[model samples]
Target: MKKGNTLFFKTRPRVRSYAAICGSKEKEGVIGNYADITLSDDMYGESTYEKAECKMLSGAISLAVEKGGLTDCDIDAMLSGDLLNQIISASFAARDFEFPFLGLYSACSTMSESMLLSAALVDSGFACNCVAATGSHFASAERQYRYPLELGCTRPPQSQWTVTGAGACVISDAVGKIAITSATLGRVRDWGVTDVNNMGAAMAPAAADTIMRHFKDTGTKPEDYDMIITGDLGALGSRILKDLMWEKSYDISSNHVDCGEIIYKVIEDEFQGGSGAGCSAVVMNSYVFTKMNAGLYKKVLFAATGALLSTVSSGQGESIPCISHAVELESLAAGAQ
Candidate 1:
């Protein structure tokens, strides 16, 4: 079951269906067309930005369940997380669903955490259907982690834009074209990076650690997976991870891609790019999964990175500890292509 820091799922529960929903800014990103629903208004009709994030998260869950041909009653459990105090976005979203909910908080890496937990539940015969979801909002996250939106504080070149979106996937016991085969749970790594604004630097070490462990545990190499996509860690972090892996004699530079780097358009002036639970969640379920469904990709290793830093920790001048969780997604029909 557990090898090194990775978990090899024997059941291989299928990701039956999924949905990615986002706002106008994300709609302008590279994979915008892949999103299931793109709203013109970032608010989604909510009075507050927090409430809007809640809407996006819950809406993604409902959308995923519906697309999977299941209703709320069929979902045995819901696993979710977000970037907010007490993770209110996920908890508030859970209020709209009937299933049991578990609020997870792993910073931006929560999407992979939720999915890994959901697959484990189904694999253990504890649940037949599980919904894994998470999200974040630029407005809500900015005020909580950095500054208030009204202040209009200037963002640094190294800073990442918290994606205003949510993504959800319905994992079921029923066999499907796509399945989660394994997961590499990350260990917290701290490189003494204290800048809260530059999350990519703070999280890249964890990403490298998990990737190396995954290859060792599974007896696979960089070429085993078609693509190795990291969650956030934006542009600079991706480069750092590559350098670190290269130092370890594992060259992943060729097939490696960072979710943050590709999430937005280069012309958007978003600096490095997007970072949030929603970044990888939406990108995988929408863009990456869509490509897999089309038989364009066979196997992918999705590593969602997160900086485990609290506002209290940052305020206290503590270094940021980071983590990443990698899930292996394989397409059943890839050989047919």
Candidate 2:
């Protein structure tokens, strides 16, 4: 991946439409205490995470396929993943569609990883077209990770709330032709922060390490890309990442941004920082896709970061481990026109 040298692969079909499907349950302004989360009688029933993920994928995929004027059979393959065990959300969602399926898991980085793989498959002549990725979130993640919201537990500022929603995207070899061109995967890194109260502190090193490697491997300067986005490193993590980069003299302060910070506007007081996997997924579909279509930015770097620690892992006194996957997206129409 030489920088400044244009590298080309067979272009995957353009992304025609992007959509987000979220649960109707209004959990806004419900914070600080764990007891505020209402699990029962919710739209997703007992399993809020998997159910909402499936619903969001169904809704987003239906809209994308419909808007793109594609039949179910027209989809060459479905590449999907989620945070659940065995990826039940993506697997169940794929069952409702007619396309061939590939289930993937990379913890929170699943969305970007799936998108990168889909783009590779399509560009490498392995598939004609593919629906890239989707993700879901539920209150259950909290119960499994920290404490059930129903327990009224107090959360530290470093903790990020898992969102209760889903997001999806459709990628193709044609239509608008905004396709992923390249990607970089980061090795897992542990900064030795174990409290989990502040994920930014734990995940910042991984984000910085990956971002630097991406530039090194690709030989692209930070200014070359219009925007450099990270997955779920909310306010705390974003700041930590910037500081770490500066310490290494990489200084990407102007272009660096985090999806976790963008998803929810009132992030400061409400969420302490921002959200989870759904954070990057929803922001990508709802915000970045629109901007790309509008021709606001030509080249963008999306780095989705994930912390690879379970409650058990943390409980066993293991350090919080983090990983990141990055993809480059560009508009073919803009370049052609």
Candidate 3:
């Protein structure tokens, strides 16, 4: 049922299985050991970076299904998105599967957005099994959103590197260890940030707004969750979000973690850190899921933030509008559901 902008899943859709596949760069990052598959080459043997992104998405979906002991025939639907125009990466990846396809475009927040829809579908009996996935490639994103990589543009200190990776989760009604309990849809918030290179600032306000709304709708506090994770707010954005929350009398400094900040070991070398459609996707599927299964984090509030800016909008000098969608995930014991 709906409570404010949050949806409470009484039936609690469980994540049956998940997979994380990343390029060599991401494979060497903090989540390196946890990813299900890591490509020795970012190209994945493909001739082009775009095709490589599609292949990564496809690989993540297939790996997730296989981990769940299922096949394409068993999946009722697939929900996916990416940073590419028209979400071509997700669309092209979907062509490799046999199930119904639902393509989404919410910038970096596509992971949580796709998972929220998948959970709702399963919880409401619209589908028995669904796969939620997304991906992004550094080279492809650079070519599309900024200058061509061939130009060797000097990245600003505030910029983040686009992660070359993909993550997928199989959500089903079947009993499982990790369950999606609720979700809070975010609102578009533009604070007049026009610097395309500084996506963290563009997205931070939305993350704070959605997280605060989720707490209000659920009658919970920041301390109620074992962790509160934001998609790709990076180091600077994460700090801004904390300050925003504190101004509202909600302090999340203790439990807050940003996927962008932790993805890399030496984050400053990559500017803030990682930022892309796959940033939160790979982190949640690899690090977060592993922690939940190990009984490390029992309750997590995951809010994936996105900057809804296109090249045309940037070119037009339009401000970047951002959004964040939050999902409440809990770790349940076997047969608890």
Candidate 4:
């Protein structure tokens, strides 16, 4: 936990750029505007549940390649993961892209986890460059994990809306070196929060724990970073996390932001709280990347949190367990003036 610039000084590999690609299936939902779904109608005509994820992953990778100004062949490798059982989304995406592949699964935290691994690979001389990650969600997730949307079941205020979008990021050693400097993996935390409907409550503890650990391990304070962002802990979880941090004396209230809350713009009654895996993915790809490129912020801590629960677990009366992945990204370019 000794924090000084050791990570930077110990190794001087350059990190170039971080690019994100996003896709979604909900074309007409009230929250669709918050996402980046723009596929043709025909694409979804015969889309099976698995195909939807595959399409999203492929679209995300293509966009990342385009935005990063690199060809698929130029990519050193592709690292991806999804909510699917066998990671079909990533597998199919790899088939289309000619890069070596490494599939990952951290649930909603997959994007950050992939980025962390990709950066490490590039910095350690193992690989010159790689596309870190991507993710997707569909209406089918709810049907499989919860009740069908048609059931009209009322979601509690603490519940988060699953976002139907996919995101991809190209991480390289050549572009601008906006690399992931470090990462801290979180341990599973269950605070006796058993409301299957309220994921925010279940995930808040893990978010707080991981954020605290990141600061402790890196010897950095909240004020040291321009932004401290969390993945998808919605409104209620965000509030609880803020309180927990205060209790732990971190006091990150001012600079802290939640991807879930920010993605939906917190419109009144528009979305009960915020969104899902795609929420953090799209926000980082579209909004955060733009701001970083514009020099709006310098150092950021990206913490994506996930609720590790299933239909079977909840049905069997199991409490929701949660985890988070935190990574720090900083600008490495020299000429600011």
Candidate 5:
């Protein structure tokens, strides 16, 4: 059933399995504890950072499928994305497998966007199994969006580090511990913040807008969810989201957490924390999934925020149009109880 911007999945596609792999730096952080694989080197033995990103993405997908006791051939579709010019990481990763591929790009919000569509496809009987995945490489993103690492440009306090990681989840028609119950499609909102360095500020408004719409459409409230997780709003953006929601009479402060703010063990050096397509992906697949399976979290409202800005658009003096897509995941055990 469709309600406003939200789509309810009666079939309840289950997350059959998931996996995450992070770079050397992330390996020293919180995500490293829960990630399935952590590399000793960010390069992963690849000559180019771009190639390393592809390898990470491919490894994540393969591991997820293997964990489910399945193979690439078992999956009907592969939906993936990355923070590259043409989503080359995802597209090239898909080449390693034989499944039908659809490469998506929603900036940092690509994880939830891909998973939302994966649920829809499985719920509609269009596919029995699908892999939703996304990844981002710090080195690759720096070269593409900002100054190359060779230049050693100083980062601003408002700037967030692009995460070097990848995550993948297999959504299947079969029953499982956690199931995707609904999804809220977000609308674009630009507040005329032209500074590309401050992505959290640019995307927070859209996060609030989507969260508000999700509550309204589903006849729910902030307290209904065990956790309200935002993908990559960092510390500054997370505060902005709370303020925006408060103005609308929805207080999410108690239950809310931003993946970007907590992905790193220490936030001082990284400034605003981590921001990338992989930030939320790795967090969801590793930490959040572990908590859910352990019965610590029964219901989760995952809203992955994205800054829809390109180097061309920014250079043209255009504002950053942001978006956030929300996916509702519920533990089947909670329902059974």
Candidate 6:
């Protein structure tokens, strides 16, 4: 049911299983130990970085379905996206699966968008089992958004490294570790940030907008959630979001954690931190899921933010438009239904 700016699912769809797959550098990061698979080579022995990204996404989707003790035939639908133009990675990967596929595009917020659709489908009984995933490749994104790999261009201080990874989750009717209860769809917000190099600042306002709306719509305090996780905000954007929350008289400092800030180690030389479609996807499916299963987090707000500016739009001197989608996840023991 729609509640103000949020969608509340009475029959919360359970997250039966998930899988996280990444490259070598990501494997060396904080959530590495929790990932289902990590490739020694970022290329994954593929001919190109784009192909490699498709492979990681395919692997994640297959692993997630397998983890749930199901196969492609059992999956009713597959929804996924990537940072690439037309979401080529997701579309190309979907070719391997016989199930119905829906290619989505919400930049880095793709994970939340895909998950929201999956939860709605499962909760509505439109699908018995659904898989939603997203991914990004460093080489691929760099070439498309910034410069080519051959340029060896210097990155600005505010720039974040695009994580070479993928993550997938299986949403089913069966009660499981965690269930998605609500989703807050964000509105596009342009804060007049024109610097394409600093995605953090460009996307911060949207994250804050969604976060505040979610709290208001649900009549919940920031303290109500065990954790409030944001996607690809890095350090600067996270701070901006906190400031915005404070302006609204809510202190989210205690439980807020940014996926970008924690995905890589501090000394990894990743400037701000990780940013990409894969950052939140991999971290949530791995670290967050593992924590929920361990009973460490009873309630979590997963808000994935995205900068909706394309290369053409940026080149045309258009301010970056950003959005965020938040999903409320709670332990099944809470009796969400």
Report the CA-based lDDT of candidate 5 relative to the real structure.
0.94
CA lDDT, candidate 1, residue 109: 93
Residues 298-326, model 2: lDDT tens digits: 88888888888877788898989988888
- List of clashing residue pairs for candidate 1: none
Candidate 3 local lDDT, 210-258, one digit each (tens): 9999999999999999999999989989989999999999999999999
TM-score of each: 0.97, 0.87, 0.98, 0.87, 0.98, 0.97
Whole-model alpha-carbon lDDT for candidate 1: 0.90
Any runs in candidate 6 off by more than 4 Å, and if so which?
333-337
Local accuracy by lDDT, each model? 0.90, 0.70, 0.93, 0.71, 0.94, 0.93
Candidate 1 displacement at residue 26 in angstroms: 0.9
Q: What tens digits encode model 5's per-residue C-alpha lDDT throughout 217-296?
A: 99999999999999999999999999999999999999999999999989988999999999999999999987887778
Q: lDDT tens string, model 4, 250-326?
A: 99889988877766544455244555566677677666765666666788899998877777888889898888888
Q: Per-residue lDDT for 53 in model 5?
A: 96
Winner by lDDT between candidate 4 and candidate 3:
3
Candidate 3: misplaced stretches above 4 Å?
A: 334-337
- For model 4, where is the 10-residue window of minimal lDDT? 1-10
Q: For candidate 2, what is the TM-score?
A: 0.87
Clashing pairs in 3: none
Question: Could you tell me the C-alpha RMSD of candidate 5 in Å?
Answer: 1.2
What tens-digit string does per-residue lDDT give for candidate 1 at 279-337? 98889889988888777888899899999988999999999999998888888865524
Q: Is candidate 1 or 4 superior in lDDT?
A: 1
